[model samples]
Target: MSNPNEVKSTLKPAYDHVIVGGGVAADKAARAIREEAPDASVLIISDVSDGPLYRPGLSKDLWLKADATLEGIDLGTTETGAELLLGTTVTALDPEAHAVTTSDGQQVGYGRLLLATGAAARHIDTPDDDRIVYYRNADDYRHLRSLVSEGIRVAIVGGGYIASEIAAGLAAAGADVSVHFPDSRLLEQMFPDSITSHLAEVYESKGISLNSGFFLSSIHAGRRLTLESRSGEKVEADVVVLGLGAVPNVQLAEEAGLEMEQGGVSVDETLATSAPDVYAAGDIATFSDPILGRRRVEHMANAERSGDAAGRTMAGTRTEYRYTPLFWSDLFDDGYEALGETRTNHRIEEVWNDAHDAAVLYYLDGDVVRGVLMWNTWGAVPKAREVMQASKEGRLKVSELAGQITPGG
Candidate 1:
């Protein structure tokens, strides 16, 4: 536990590097900074009560366990001797002075600053109630777990990966789960109608209710909440969980007068923001991607890689962040690893296995392969990345890549 009074009294004049967020990106950046500049003083400040942990596990592995304590989830100590100031919020940033003001009214200067502020769960217009949860951190998981019981009705909002994973986990925990989303199918943004239908069937077989194209109209909170949809349909549940997706935490960057693009802090290929001596990474950074142009990646892999690159650059090693991100999610017996952009707008070429239980989908923009989706298949991430790169470089045609990727391969 950190004491605000003590931290303010003993604060140093300045540090070599200061990271503004305590998520995976900050953790990796601290380590990379230590490796590059051993003598540099590093300080990590975050509003999270706990230090960096495996955030993705909160929705998946943690919910499935009978006794899911937040143990063994820490990212572990860094060799950088970085001082951690947890449970503290940054109030303001001064780019010209190369300093930041915290909520405690203490200004800390830094030679190089990193804004890995990440994103927060998007809130909806719902009544205030203990049963209403906007799932984001470990605390949210603990609260939801305590409410899960046999036959407990859980109404989930949004049809993204978080809602899907939580629905599956709640069903396994003996809760009657109902998913309500405006999309016609789950993961509608990532998959086409064909893949969405298959995923819907898997959830339906597990006794989970799939209420698609139902926009939430109103919520009447009580011991049991009554939810009314736009279509005049009513559904009652013991608890309501919102997984409506995340909006990047860019207030600090915006206040500091940093450049913005694509709804996030704009950064160059090296993760350097428009402001001098300041960099942004992870969910808050719309970095210049070597392959995809300027884009913001929300997955954990991108966070780690971009943070490492930013740290190295801050430590005087100029390097470009060119790594491709691979995202994965597990739902019951089915799981997938996807490389590149998985948006459904592109033409998708799918190959099903002989058993009809597995599949691989190649996202093509004309004759070029833009992305790859491995359904119920693992360990094909590297191959998928190779195919995407080859297509981008015009070394392989979509037809040639299609024949090479099989369902099992």
Candidate 2:
């Protein structure tokens, strides 16, 4: 989609590599390139001018108080002394022409291009809706901070991390918060019913409404909106927020003629896109998970790990990106952690209580330790990880592994 002469005129002879997207993945890739290709020039381009900031940690500390600043958090300058292009959005990529253009009409040439565009919060396709806010970036956090003042009634739609974390923060701020989810349990796809119920109990204890198995049908704007559940129940809210998961930012890759699958850029173990001289990682790339034996997309911790690996690989050191999916969440005073993929068939076998602040759920698929759910048990994660690693390697059995890997007394 470019004029031949114009594309030809924009080619630059120098870059060791170029990274598009300014999120965690792009930062990781750039760092890896500098480490491996010490003499090569590297460049990073992104629409967000603030550079790189830790997003997952932001919801916990920064967004809770209205005074936190997000400036100077960018992933520091490139390691190879490469150029940084801030506040620039790449509008088009002409792979055939070996050039990419930004929305502001800046043409960039790259020897190898890494697309780690990441994802944005899913905004519901609603008509005449302006009251609903979805938090994704630093600006969104700041906006929510200002809107949430003190003792405000906040309604969070969707389940999982966003809804849970926002509810926790709002409750801590002395606001009446309601978290609505389409499922009866929190993180239904990842956590078991028992775990979700436990989280619900904790939230309820903190004066937060855990409205699971409910959906928002429509909204009205008058400083309050109406929410209808599938069971015909209704709710009124002061401010509404949606955390309906995320859709991968895949337009740039798709337009460049890179292959994609299951709404993500499909890649092998190496994190290379189907197109030549192109790569992808983070929430936008789907790859085979050796632990689960399936093609999957991990959004948080695993995504960063894989992104770092891809950056290293692009920098000239080749390594496979593989890790069991691990996650943790905090709700008020209670904290929950889980490792590996939970299987429905894995009935909880060994339930243990320790220090009255921790509980462990051991799941077994036949004789294998398929999954684990830990509450207030931050110390046991490492041992559980080891057991899961051994299980993935076909070397551990649930019955025999228990006594060997007992929770810290």
Candidate 3:
């Protein structure tokens, strides 16, 4: 699992902290700038020549753990000495000559950079071939785990959360799964229909195939893989996974002008990036969020707490990054845990248990409490972020967040 084309393409013109990306928020911002500037010279460029990855274990435990190992999610880059230029791809971002312009023309330089160019896997116009598998990263989960055998037939498409955890890791490796989606449930903009009708009756009680409202329209990739939809409904398979979600890499922060938002790359609060010495963390960072305010958080706990607060504010320790992270998933046994903006027009509020299999929803908006899931509820994410920081600060009160975290109230 390491040979992403053998990497290490050489580059050392300059670097005190360069970064750009190599996922897991540039390996936790080059191990938090070598633990706060210890001789600091880190580099980490990465366009996936795969050197340090753990991308949510490429959709949960490399397909539901059977002694999972891609060298066990190796995010080591030689334990943070951070050189790694693997497969490069910076392509220009002068940012006032602090420099950066790879893709081979070379022009390194940097004193403090870091963009964490993470995200990109949301296609779906269809027909691309090799039995189409847009499933992001770890080389599409080792090419769909070398095409699982037992009954094969996959056909995923997007029902969110990486196509429901790659249809529970290709139906626990025996394949013959089938998800499709046009939202009739399955994270319909974030659960609730009482947990999306018990998560579509536990993925149709395991045999899978819940084509829900379909609507994909085209994708015929030869030898086996049809998928028509949009009022037609075809769905053959062999392997077709798209999981349409993730777009953030932000074209090198929109060609280096930086400062964008919502669609990400606007920093501040120490993740810096107005340009001076630059910064920006995980999922192209839109950061802010004192309590779910600004956004852009493609999970993995906001890329290791926004790459250790943008590598300790690019190693000088400015570190602020208000951190409102906390994301989790796993579908088969319904593991959950969430935080902030769980959407679906925001007013949620659950708390179930008796066989609905543990819950605690609560999304609210008028009285604050931005979001909190916890389904299959476990240690209660710091008591649901202290009841969403006391409902974002008015001290609870939306009928007291219904049994607050659902203890015995």
Candidate 4:
């Protein structure tokens, strides 16, 4: 990776397409653009010191292998001829002039622009300390790997998937792990109490202390860090891991006067922003979904498909993004893959196996199936998606759908 500050002179004055992110979305978009127009020049500007790699691996594979280096989890080479400007930050956007200014005061013009800026980890009000870590990028993974040892005390703050995965990983690695969250149950927003209970039990069985219905109020670092809850209860730990959610990186879009929707840059079905020749994809784009209406998806599958669509559209192919995104996570011996919205308030119908080890949950908004969650169940995603599509068109009854997917099947 080239140093953006020192290599300012090496940057080109302009490019046919300029992408301002270095995640999966940017990589896919660059590849699509090259496929559509082989002769066009493409450049990718990213703040990450390393080039594009699988972000999800940082939480799963990298954490599981304490000796794993960032190079070991590389997503392989991007065949796109896009010049990557690593360790670089875009400071200003000039839509009218079709150009952007980097932190080093370098003005680079673009015939077409893409903002796949992704997101940043949300933080809490805890005091600064070497033992405190927010799980987000490659650097965080490396730092946490160094801290995990036999009997090492780890307190994870959050009830989301990241927290669950980290707690499971650390616990399996012989660390004394505890999970603290403000919710009454784990994954409260996505799963009902019944499902969350099963998940919590799994963590408890693995020797992970479950601290529910409380959030960290203060952090005092000393020989061992003391974390006080809002209700005055406390727990001491050697290190703290924050799994708070993320906020989309929308400053560039906001400054450029692009329309915003639901905390992201609003784009049409073709993934084109309001500004001429400008597009947004991945977590930063609040795009129009053919089936789910207007929404922004932060998962990896959505980033890949949406970025490809946006790249094709930018290259004058006039493509429309119309795929449903599915996100999956594995923790210990359990995992789930889900598509569509999985809100807890929805009417749910579930089928559990004889051993209660696997289940399929159907979320309904009125008589329409809004989402499907397959717990420890694989090879059912296609069927689930088909069921949802059919339900949306008022073609399938809930009872008929339930009969199709028995617990054993």
Measured by TM-score, how close is model 2 to the native structure?
0.85
In model 1, where do residues sit more than 4 Å from their true spots? 1-9, 78-80
Error of 1 at 171 (Å): 1.9
Residue lDDT tens for model 2, 106-210: 787777788888887787765455456787876676667667767777888888778788778777777788888887687676556656677778878888888
lDDT of 4 by residue, 128-170 (tens): 8979999877767778878888999999999987888888888
In model 4, residue pairs whose N, Cα or C atoms come closer than 3 Å (at least 3 residues apart or on different chains), thus clashing, are: none
Q: lDDT tens digits, residues 1-409, model 3?
A: 5463254566679888888877777777777778888788888777776776788788888778889888778766666667787777888888888989888788889988888888889775766676687877777777778877789988887888888888888888888888878878877898878778878888888898777788788888777888887787687788888888888888877887878988888888888878898888887788777776788888888888888888987788887988788888878776887888888898887777666668788888787878888877777788888888877778778887667776321
- Write down the worst ten-residue block by lDDT for model 4: 1-10
Q: lDDT-based ranking, best first? A: 1, 4, 3, 2
lDDT head-to-head 1 vs 4, winner: 1
lDDT of each: 0.86, 0.71, 0.80, 0.85
Q: What is the TM-score of each predicted model, taking all chains together?
A: 0.94, 0.85, 0.37, 0.94
lDDT of model 4 at position 304: 90
Worst 10 residues of 1 by lDDT: 1-10
**lDDT at 228, model 1:** 94
